[model samples]
Target: MKKRLTWAAAIAAAALSGCALAPGPSLDSKRMHDDLGAPTDTTVYDVKLITPQLIYALKQADEADAATKQASLSTQALPAESADYRVGPDDVLGIYVYDHPELTRGASGNAGNDMSPLVDIGTLQASGGLGGVLPQQISALGTNGQGEVDTSGQRVAANGTIFFPTLGRVHVDGMSTQQIAALLTRRLGSQIKNPQVDVRVMQFRSQRIQVTGDVKNPGQLSLTGSALRVVDAINRAGGGNPDADLQRVLVTRGNRVMTIDVNNILNRGDLRQNIALQSGDIVHVPDHTQNRVFVFGEVPKPQTVFMNQGRLSLADALAAAGSIDTMNANPRQVLVIRHPNPPLAQLDGTQGTVQEGLKKVSYAPEYNKPEVLRLDMTQVDSMMLATQFDMKPLDVVYVGTAPVSRFNRVLTEIMPTAQSMFMLWSIARNR
Candidate 1:
């Protein structure tokens, strides 16, 4: 019996040697691993101890970053009045000459059907600059006093040139309306005395921009007359949805991609963020579904916390997870894991080639290493520090287990195995 008791004692000691392995779910401190590795002072992941001063500095840095971005974007944004739009293929032109009623195509009021060898008002107007940003009003603006320039003008040929009576087929492609009128006047001067020629865009069919995601009405907007600014197009699209994340709006223009914070334009009334949109630009407003933080371990309820308006304090996230379990949780130790977002780099789709003959640039995203942070919740100022600490997306807050509780669990698990071994030893001795 004495030898059996000694054997049991040895088994218990062996079980205690393996006690380092966790008997249950537990989050370990990285400090132990840091000391075990390569005699280096630095741990694998960044471990920031939560403090009041650190939280304040982070807040200051965030404010400075936002201000710098705002200033930089404002300088690069287009002016309020962008350059006049040039005529393009599929565009419609309305030509009006003062005191030249006989020369105008539909000026004779043949219901614009009879094509004058010179001006065909019948073929014109039925087509056409977007007529200001409000293309719906194109029907009200007429060069021949007809209903709409779109319905009354001559649509530009696919070759980007328009044909008129005296000018024959003068090149109007890529030329602004003012430039077109001046060129026509110079050419028509040979046929008439100082012809007062006026050219206005009746229809703008060449350039279109798409607005999608989180908007009330996601669709295309025409770039007619003047260039459409970002804000103007969004307003035209019926604003954004309730869960729209305006702070991270993405605008993809061909090979270039830009992140615009629409909140500056809507909340702070900063119009500089409203950059001029180009044809083929795709504006996307993402929602708040991606803005979330996870809380787990030693908590009453482990769940995800959704950030409101792109902001969530660490304290709030912990509270939503039901704080910490007082029974077996160690208030002295808490952990936070944060992974940085990969750089945003998306170019022209699957074509992979930015443009023909140009080498395809690789936009392979570089993922950053995640950071692990420690907090001593038992400290008096810890609550205050947590309140000021802003939580980012994909952050994980973990409450560590009490050391005594962990040791007890280890003993509890091993004791049953130890008891089973002792029972088998007793049966062997009897045999």
Candidate 2:
């Protein structure tokens, strides 16, 4: 009997080793939960469901804070009256002198003059000469008998001044063309008898604004009339592309950049984000590429969901993944793995105090440490909590399998092997 037992034990050990080394489909149960990597440096947090009133209050606070920030950054106030387009350096101005045709180069008399068509005012002034600058620009006004503009318009110099015949240097920066014409008329009064000066901005080359990224026609937009609002520039560029994220549309001014949610303005009637863009403002509508959240485990479709309109609630993400399995999913063990770091809230999305949310749920303060938060979907009001929970980029949502289902799975896997072993034992005994 001892020898028989020893032989059976030896055979069983050899069989187990052979199966371990076998190159074939694994007999082990295949499930997503099986590949859940070992947990390391994880802090678990439970869902905190607040009253509807509290949620409303929190939203109000966030909106107010956003409004205040928007107002402070919008340096130029919305114009009460139609704002005049101010001239800047490098703008081309068409100067016309009535009756005194000789004052302008375009006049028939000056056609043969030894002057280039476009005379740079700044260059002429630097050379300690005033005669050439005026003829170069004003000659266009006094055309030859054919009534054609011979000279190019006067270009505003870098120093915001334009040189006229006798009027050495006149500052025109930030002044309207009409304002410039009036000033020139007064200055040219002594030189030319009753000088009637007429200034017309031929080409608005100064206020060049860039509206790029995600627009159908992205390029430089010239700010011609009244101050161009953020929306006007967007419209001028043929609006945002289909995949453009209206939320978090960036407006870059000099060193500072501000993101505005156009969706909020359209849906929630939040007009604070519609800023009057100044010169040098670059409007960029980014493509909705990075807006995604991962969902795995017991869901019918464990996949990544793109955040629609720069926002995806917890419920939305779960729904996008086809929701948790009703039969075998642990509703209490829905895990959200997130890492706390950096400038807190995103530029435009569901606004929430990161510190407050993390602290309220007792999350780890260390940014490097990953936090494993448990959202109990079993509760009746859990959906409300999910609505308030906004999904961030790269957030992983995992639904755990029910304990009983796991046990049944294990049992199903072992029962076949157990039956085979019993059959082998009986065969050996019979032999």
Candidate 3:
């Protein structure tokens, strides 16, 4: 009876020890319970049943949306294209006469005295004594120091009012080159038979656009004519650096400011957001400090991923971090923590449902819908499925221990005792 009781006690102790030796739930599971309370299986599918913190984040995102709408409304009152652009003080103009050579003399007269019928009329490159002539002629005009040249080799006064031998002081400010040329032709018609005048920009010194931040090179870029688009300016700056946040490009012209998504143009091929640039405009490329997502847990290489273009999905993010640990990974518990903003919130909220709906709606795995994702790394066949899971920034992919790992640990602990007991029982039976 005593032997029976001892054996029973031994068995109970062994069973109790075995239970203790078994692996507990993962650290992430424990943390989830502690930080977010117990996660119910039902709540996993329903966003409404999520934690209050998540709901608060969602509300904050909604508030941001409202603010964005209000700001957009304010800009709606402003003209789509600015009309305040006037020929400002000290602004340079490029003058060209096309086929008419005599009317296209340089204001500085540095083109040499050969008096050729046709001039290349290149941009003004004043050197040595030639630079003084143009500025001096411009100062003589009664108007501001802005200068002009007429067909008769006459330099206009500072006020852009040049008195030709026939036509006296005509105001050329606030007028297009074509308009000014036509006016000159009309003025000179009576003096000279069938006079022709031509004008083109020579220098773009006054028409400047400031490009600052996150570019390979950042500084003031020249805008010659109306051809200097936003992309042209960025290209002039040597394009965005590796870490540039192409999503938010700010353009401020006077009191008006516009935010353009350059990434949309590059990535999605959306040309609508490509806006035309204007003079005295500031193109600020802010540092891409915010659009980063951290990948942790059981990924092979955990890191903070920089998002260059539009929204980054979950699977893309995971692949970027060298993929999850397939050897000891659990795909079902992949956690994606996104911004509380509406677009991201909406994306994350619909993820599970979309994935599930795909499997239900589409018979083929490849035809699966967007957002519904499952991670099963058990077989090599599931590799494609793993690849299909989209990843968002700041997403956490945890690959827990394989079942074999847990079983090995438990079996190793029990094997020594089991072997010793078998040996002792054999010795007693032999005796």
Candidate 4:
């Protein structure tokens, strides 16, 4: 034990021979952040300066994103409303063939031996129940004048076919109502002269979108005859929860996953993000637990701060972290390290390098792959600008250490070892 202590002491003495062992660059904050400067009032500023270009670049990127999303929705996602809705299994189809009252007689309302009556949805609802439902609301939820359900209306079998008086069990899966009517018309042409046939979908029960995760009411939302958008579905589900991260709403359709910025629609009224939701789409509004900004460096309390609906500013983040350490913090050279959206780590299936992933927003784009947004909190103009300058998710707000504080830190690192070595030297000489 004595030998081991002696060896350990010798090793410590040799290790402490260096004047200091402080990590990080000794360069002052100003020198380190040479590219960043005060916010410019004019539109035309030096391209070399980083902060001014950020707002414009971010605006451009947002527009590009919105356009891309809109294009995807318009071209690929949104189904054409003008086209007739194809009848599927469980759908209530009202069929009538003119001159043959026998074929149309039993199919007026939900009164049939083979099928069950459509349950009153409004009765099942918690709020008003069956008593609270308005006549119009009931009409909307159930079949209205548009296509009133028939008593003898045939329910499509699980096999996707319905039995008509003369047609027997016909495969009407993926066939539009008009097409089905024309098929019946042509097939019955042999028996009757000009068989005027009409077919309409009374109840749309086959298609539904599921709403899960942080929402007031999470369940399957039935898709009606009319087209439903993301907003409409959310509203029907009793809106998002208080902690819901509406900015990063996830819509999973089969294998494809889409991130929707629903915050834009509710706040800025950006209609583009409110894309039409198709049947079987699962909308999951995640909580704000992951949507946060980190405050570090010379902040009094360096911690994660949750952003309410993605509206956190530099000032807000600072305030949440108990404000900056004014004594040691270089307020003039504050840095906000912003990682790319969906971060480079989590690729959005896009083929791009680290630099390209950043979306070209900052002056530090060359050396710093992730943007380093600088803000001079010392300046009144700059500080005011920081209020308007929104902080995105995963932004690292760093109040650079003061030059004097950096020097003090180096002294602090070496002082304890220096004192120990001096005491040892005195002890050996006195012995």
Candidate 5:
């Protein structure tokens, strides 16, 4: 009878497994949306300069050292006025004399020491020959054909060399105003009594630097007496936009090109990369390229998202992508397609742990002791469960349906006992 009962139980179990429950609405099985609108091979990965591991290492390395690094980065020499000055062609000069009135040129006329009307030496003639100095009539008081002083100034051919009465031809080109004035004073000391001279730039016409790229207003800015820095040029060009890549600023002077990290210099005070600009230098700020990731399919709001740090993980990326749509999301079947190489190593390691655990279980005693099974999904949760593991720049994640095989087995086991009980109740009622 026991044998017959066991046979009956085994046959009932088999029959129940094959029996199809009336396919009413299948509430037991999870409904998965296969029409998840075309499978997209698109993903967004953040580009990070410093890896999380590296950041952790840095944090671990500097418990107290962080303060020192911060101080060092913040401590920069106050930006002093730059003294490196260059005299370019066409820059105007104003020569003056302190006590010696006969040696200076004021705004009005060449009073006692002042020279005649302002000389507009039309752009300097660097190309030398004979008539290199383009002659223009200068109205100055001088002895006419007869060696006599004329009170009324008359237009005369002022030789390129403004004969400062005694001083000879003094080439102004390439020489600074101070150098020219000192030379003139030394020469006049031989003829005039105490000669005091001063030199100043009255106007700046030629000195210009080109400013270009990603600026509101870009053009040539003239450098006057005050020195110009990288920031000054940027300011002149109406500054950069909020999204400008200040770190990639470029300064090209003639044949040489210098890259300046303006962001670092401004924020961290790293002056090592802050370069001095020169005349004719081109300051360029190229447009920043869009670095972003497109997130779609099973997300709350499927759209493209940008990252400043340039890198994101599967879990973190999902969060940024507005996370899985809880209504349609199957969290267990989250599929992350990554590069087939590097991720394999990580997968192997994880699989190794899993395999070792399985092997240990296979050899474990039949005694059922309460064993703690810790599934660490929170830490390193970015890693996917399958073979091709490490995610690349762009990867597609497909969240699938829940595993229904085990649930089906549970139903199969319970249905037979319930059916037998119902049949027995019907027979008892008939009796």
Candidate 6:
């Protein structure tokens, strides 16, 4: 036992002596970030000097935030009359002729040239439920002044005209139900006694919109009316796909194109982009490509933070990633890596090709070019710097750790092994 004790003491003494002789921890945060600033192929910009740009960006952001709030505050609904869905081709309409019961028969029975009793839509539906007779299918049973039995209800032709009994071919292409009824009433007043007509649109089949790209179901949709908003159309297409970029939905109508940030509408209650959709419009939700900023290094979460309202700043990115690890991180050594803006090429008399232009722009700098910015919060206010520095997509925010903190972390990891060795040495010496 005594021999074993002597060997253990010798081993413990040698281990302690080796640790004492070893070089001290040299993980200086400022020195480590020195290479981060003004390094090879990197252009360093001091945050203090760019106060003018920061002020402009922050002012714009504040104005935009206020505008978003103002939009949400407005409670006035869109004018109902302004959204009057104009009647179009393929629409099913229910026509009613006052005082003439025989003129209002369903499409089922043939237009009997005789004066037959008119069975109203309510009576027909009540007899055998909805399957009995639909209101929109109701048509005049008796013949017109020309003695022709028009059994088929009015179907707006491809040429935007509908064949009527006495009225012959009526052009109802952009006309409303009320306008059609008034026209029929005025024409039929001369033929019949005190003629009055009523028209109501039953089925809206004309306005078909196509929703594609990042939608659960990408296909054409028949809009019920002009009331179909952008949000409603997206929902009708089975909502957005899992990887859909809600912030950058493109809506195209011929030459006019607009991008809608649905995240602002859904999350921040901004409804300015929730505009009314038109016929032949295309709504496309694209895949989430460049919608996140990376905050790594000494942050608590060190995660890729997604943006709202399609805009993000350093302050928002840091807050989203749970801020920097204050216990072990140096707030003074914050670095943001960004892409450098390429200068415009000298335009010649001739138009240049896209590839040639790209090549010319490539001469400016690569995307990974170290356009690094060091944010020294120790000298200036931390909040001020964070708010001023606008973080673009794919920008990397890294917070480095202090040298003393790094040394402390190293010692914490080695302390357990050192303590065990010390205990063994104490036991051996006592023995």
Please, what is the TM-score per model? 0.69, 0.69, 0.51, 0.69, 0.45, 0.56
Residue 92 shift from truth in candidate 4, angstroms: 2.4
- Scored by CA lDDT, what does every candidate get? 0.70, 0.70, 0.54, 0.70, 0.49, 0.66
Question: What are the runs in model 5 whose C-alpha is more than 4 Å off?
Answer: 1-52, 56-84, 100-103, 106-169, 290-320, 324-377, 380-431
CA deviation > 4 Å runs, candidate 6:
1-59, 62-81, 101-152, 295-305, 308-333, 337-374, 377-392, 398-431
The digit string of per-residue lDDT tens for model 6 on 172-249 reads 889877898898888888889777676655556777789999889889877664477788889988999777888767
Residue 165, candidate 6: Cα error in Å is 1.3
| lDDT (10s digit) by residue, model 1, range 1-431 | 77766766776677678867848887667645554456654535658888877777867976786676666555543334648888888876667665564344322221121122322433344443222212343334333454433234667889888788766787888898899989988888999987877776665777788999999999887787666878888888888889888777878777656667777777878776778888788988888777788899999999989887777898899899889999989987788887643212232233232211112334322233566778898888889888888987678899999999999999999998888777767754764
lDDT of 1 at 378: 80
What is residue 302's positional error in candidate 1, in angstroms? 1.9
The residue-by-residue lDDT of candidate 4 on 1-431, one tens digit each, is 56555755775676676535557667556657565577654533222222646766876897796686667756665556544666788877877665464565223444232234444444445344332333444333333235553354678899999887776888887788899889998999998887877776666767779999999989987665566788888888899888999988878777666778898888998887687777789998899887898898898899999998778988899889888897899977778777655442333444334322113222323322466667876665776677767888788888888999999999999998798867765655454
The sequence of per-residue lDDT tens digits that candidate 5 reaches over residues 1-431 is: 56555656666666577656655665533476466579885544432222355345634654344344334323432234446333445544445544343444431223221123342333222322111222221122122335332333211122223334445445555455667677878877877677666655444544678888888888888765566778878987899876565755777766545556577667877665554555677888865453344556667767655434333445555666677666555555455433322111222222221111002112221121211111112335333422112223344454443346446668899997788867655544454
Cα distance off (Å), candidate 1, residue 22: 20
Ten contiguous residues with the weakest lDDT in model 3: 353-362
The true-versus-predicted C-alpha distance at residue 409 of model 2, in Å, is 3.3
**How would you encode candidate 2's per-residue C-alpha lDDT over 272-358 as one tens digit per residue?**
677777778898998877657889999999998888877888889998888899989999888777645422334333334333211
CA error at residue 20 for candidate 3, angstroms: 30
For candidate 3, write residues 226-297 as lDDT tens digits: 556677789889998877877767777776566676876777675655666777788888776767767776
Colliding residue pairs in candidate 2: 104-138, 104-139, 105-138, 105-139, 106-139, 106-140, 106-142, 106-143, 107-142, 107-143
Q: What C-alpha root-mean-square deviation, in Å, does candidate 3 show against the real structure?
A: 13.3
**Candidate 5 or 3, higher TM-score:** 3
- Compare candidates 2 and 3 on TM-score and give the better one: 2
- Predict model 3's lDDT versus the native: 0.54
Model 2 gets an lDDT of 0.70
